[model samples]
Target: MSEPLSVSERDGHCSLVLTRPARGNSLSADLVEAMHEALDSAERSGVRLLSIEGDGRNFCTGFDLAGLEATADGELLARFVRIEELLARIWAAPFTTLAVAQGRTFGAGADLFAACSVRLALPDASFSFPGAAFGLVLGTRRLARRIGEDAALSVVTSGAVIDAERAARLGLATGIVQPDELDAVKQRARRDALRLDTHTIAALRQAAGDNPIELDRDLAALVRSAARPGLVQRIIAYRAKAQDKNRTDRAAAPSTFQEGAVR
Candidate 1:
């Protein structure tokens, strides 16, 4: 199997590419660990900017659901805790963090995008936070902070897929750009990231209300949610419902032949 993540560093910038196209770059345990490792490396190297993108059609489809049948509730809770930790790290990072998302960025994947300082979504991108469907309270505060509390509440409760335009309107996405424009965006981000010295950057982050207490509360919420009884069962039921809806939608969709016949 190929490595789930690719990390590259240049100047004071570190880039993390999610390489698990087969898995829709989902946050598997290995992938999450790789990300933490990359973050550690970037911090040690004094990286001023960190950018995250995924290879293939989709950015990330959220948590890896494969082998969930065999995964115990305790194990699932542990995985969620680690994911929350990763998000908290990104949310509180002194350096700038950028996420360029395309295709489906769902659940915790959306949370990851929200954690970034610069969230750039491609025209084809869509986002949904369905962790609430499975009774997971991950990243609620960060998301509310990014957008507004009312908007965040609506999005989280509705579990509706927000297109790139809608995401930008909601302030869930900082900007929307085509794939070709990404390099220029990155250039701008890097420039902005380096505008202040490292020390001043850290100071600005603190001054801008990067609250450790709130982060701790977010983590606590996640732990409380994930530690609930029958977590695996709840997730299983949620996935089943989603799969049923997808099948129903597909069945109701008009096929090419049917459309031609109608015409």
Candidate 2:
């Protein structure tokens, strides 16, 4: 198989693109590992900006459901831990980080977008956080920091879907543009990012005081939740309900169930 992820350097930005189009760019164990390595490489290369995007129809649909079902608990825990660590790294990156989301961005994918310094989306992009339905605590604190506590709570609890417009209004997305304009927007952002020296960027982040001390606690809670006697069974049941709802919604009209693959 070809690489599931790829990274390249441009004028002033390191671009990371998820390459698992056929799989809806889901975050599989290997893909997550590749993402972690890419982020590390971006930081070490001193890139002024790091841009992340998906190469397929959707930005991402969350964690890989098939992998989740197949892996043993020990291996699954390791993957989840690495995923949380990757999110934390992105959240704390000294330089600018941008997530250019298109199509669907859900679940851990939404968490990844939430962790970025700036989130830009195409006009048709949609986002949702569905982990709560599965009792997962991933990225809760960081998301609240990004979009405020009240909105974050509503989002996670309700599994509400938001388009690019509402996403920008709610502070979840920084900006929205037409799909064809994505490259130009990225170039503009790249220029703006390159203008800031590394020290200045670090100083800005420091002054913002966005350091998150509670994320570790949240991760611990997620571990506990996952280890509950019937949590996996609950997850399977929840997925069944979601799938039924999706089918009903699709039959009613077009399905708006873009809330990632917590399924």
Worst 10 residues of 1 by lDDT: 254-263
lDDT of 1 by residue, 1-263 (tens): 89999999998899999998877889999999999999999888899999999999888889988899899999999999999999999988879999999988988889999999999999999899998888899888888888999999999999998999999999999999988888998999999998876677777777877778878899899999999999999989998887777666667884621110000
Cα-based lDDT at residue 36, candidate 2: 87
For this target, which candidate reaches the highest TM-score against the unseen true structure? 1
Per-model C-alpha RMSD: 4.3, 2.4
The clash count for each model shown is 0, 0
TM-score (C-alpha, index-matched) for candidate 1: 0.95
Model 2 has a clash total of 0
- Over 4 Å off, model 1: 254-263
Q: After superposition, how far is residue 188 of candidate 2 from its true place, in Å?
A: 1.5
The worst-scoring run of ten residues by lDDT in candidate 2 lies at 254-263
lDDT of 1 at 248: 69
